[model samples]
Target: MTIPQQSGTFVLVISTGGTIACTTDPATGARTPTLSGEDLVRACGTTEEVRVFDAVSLDSSAMTLADVDTLVELAGKALGDANIAGIVITHGTDSMAETALALDLVHDDPRPVVLTGAQLPADHPSADGPANLNRAISLAADPLARGQGVMVTFGGDTFAARALIKRDTAERRAFALTAPLTVPRPAPAARAALAGIDVPILRAWPGADASLVDHVVAAGPDGIVVEALGSGNVSTAMGEALGRALDAGIPVVVSTSVPFGEVSFDYGGAGGGASLGARGALPSGWLRAGQARIALATALATGTDPRLLLGV
Candidate 1:
């Protein structure tokens, strides 16, 4: 079923290649992102009078920080246009959550920016790209979606960009909201650029030493995110390395490895959240490790202390 083109409410759809645009190469039998934006739109059965633009055409796993920045700029430009009612982005699901969050942090236009993608390739018998695209377009054109910020619409649910996370690698309903939508008070000013700062995630493991953490710090990153165990506890050695990172003025944000819980500086031990907090590490509330990394990088780029931005 195709959505009829309406006279008003113009929508702009941007396509960044992902599984949703993949097809099997006849000779090599390999899947690749070769479909054009128009092709996907047509496949989705949409007859809406919307503009389409191709931002990039690579599988999402191959997406770089440069691509993300480009997409942010493109979306910002489209949202700024008076003729465009809203924007829909078809992206690779692998990094859709991160890209969505990045866009959310930089753009404050209050216009809907809906992102959606398919888990299976477009040529697959049960491919979901068409249906997801259809829903994203519907959401984008909805007046109610405004002021709700960027959103990810998938599997019949619309999630705030700040709270979206990809919980499964292969499920159609892969993304989920792990935390409550955080409405930044005194709305954030538009960011001039998204500085692609390298912020690595260090996962704490049982009986693990600080060697890995030491290596990461030695590499000179703008910040580090520790995927702490439990309510934010790491190995004593890992904790020590985090302290060193903080001492060096490299901000460290601690996020829980658990799927659904807030990080807190409650326990008291060498590598406990409390110890880390005392040593200058900040809690990430309920954000998962990956999301925390995005927040930390954005904070560092904008010259805002992540601890304050996150309200730790």
Candidate 2:
């Protein structure tokens, strides 16, 4: 699949280690991120003058919040460079959605930032990295992809960073958007930052108790995200613990564990959504638990009230 490219357009490829850049270790038979950004560009067979920068060389599972901050800084610098037309980031799919959403919130640049990766290692016979890299570069180079905020282009589809989610564990087309990308906005002068803060996610399972919630609250995290049961229902004890966290001024966001549904405050029992809402628990709309956590962290880092962004 070939995408039209403009003459003299230069693309900056930032490589962070993921399966897309991994190779098999002969001794251990384990895959690792050993390929460079230049190698990826070479595999794609692109003729455009590409500048490669190796950001990190580790699987996405090993990625940290600090790594995310570094990637955002690199992308911001690349987008500011006059010689660069756009940027492509090769990332691991494990936390791709979280990283993408983080970048979208902070990177206001209109220039395209395309994130892509593969399920198979680079040295595998059926490695998908080359193809995904090609598609990402094509999207990054295309004028039509500009000003769409940061996007993930995988499996021949493009998703807005804010709405993108990793839906499948081992599927080639792992990402899907909860919503669509809208208008472009100016890149903010200052990007959001995190300090390795603790933000625990507690799921409301059958016969769930408040012990986990109490422990998390005692840890004094910046916020908490609860993957509540259908329609955001929690056990009585869990709801009370969440209420206590909110009362202590720690933001509590309730998200549905269900893949596709909005959390509502309709039920009004001891451990119901409405009860939690009355005690200051906020609804996460349709955001998944991970996305809600990212949003909450970003909001706290930027000194913005999380409730304002969450529409609670």
Candidate 3:
């Protein structure tokens, strides 16, 4: 699986824990994502042509926005180095899509930042980790992927960071594009999304309230997407703030804070899911909250209407 190492291309493979690094105990058969970067790289068998950098290692699910910023800074610095060609990040599938979008926003460099991971661990014979890594490495090393923004390579597909959403948990084919996701999309659509969606969550207050919304709006948010709790329930105060944002012509999208379920406006009344809707906060409906944010950001970045993508 060795590629002819390019003369000057340096590929940085950041290993954030996932099935790609995981191994199962023969006795228990329980799954885990804890393999090392060097081990995973050796398993992938790369040639001497491309130099590999084993970057920081951690679990993607437990990752924070701060981690994203740090990674972006590292990537920016790496790209600044004349020897580096591109970068590859092996992240947990759980929040891989989120990290990809965040990285895409922060790193303005055209060098490819490809994210890859598996639903199964490296120990499994049929595990998809090796292949996914190989593909990511190749794509990361490709000049065409440069200036294309961050990407997620899995199941033999190369997805734009802005268009991608991790839609599955245990399946190998998890990341997919938004509606009418192009078969082979290019940089324009990707950049269009990156412009506005790049707004990172600097901090979040637990109880939803207008103060927070005011704070966010005053900070000059083109739009704000709330990662609300179950069924889109936020504090009544938060709901009021949301309504204010809507009244002020600010677009607010509500997505479930829960990671694994469809966001339903089932809280009935009083600024619950339905109330949020009545207040003009668009419900994510089917899109995962994080992915929904990315789509909204991309739309805002390109001056494309968020309602158009939301179809609300």
TM-score leader: 1
TM-score of each: 0.92, 0.91, 0.65
Candidate 1 has an lDDT of: 0.81
**lDDT, residue 61, model 1:** 77
Candidate 1 at residue 307, lDDT? Answer: 66
Clashes of 3: 13
Tens digit of per-residue lDDT, candidate 1, span 15-101: 999989999877997889988888988898876667688888988878777788788888876665676778999999888888888
Over the stretch 197-259, how does candidate 3's per-residue lDDT look in tens digits?
A: 444332224564567677877776777787777767787777777778778877778876565
Q: What is the lDDT, from 0 to 100, of the residue 307 in candidate 2?
A: 61
- C-alpha lDDT (0 to 100) for residue 267 of candidate 3: 83
Model 2: per-residue lDDT, tens digit, 1-312? 112233466888889989998899999999888889889989988766777888888888787888888888888766666667889999999989888877877777678998999998988898888988998888888888777888898877778776457888888888886544432322442576665766778889877888998898888988899989988889888888888888898988898778765778899876899999888888887677887887788787877767655545
lDDT of each: 0.81, 0.80, 0.69
Q: Between 1 and 2, whose TM-score is larger?
A: 1
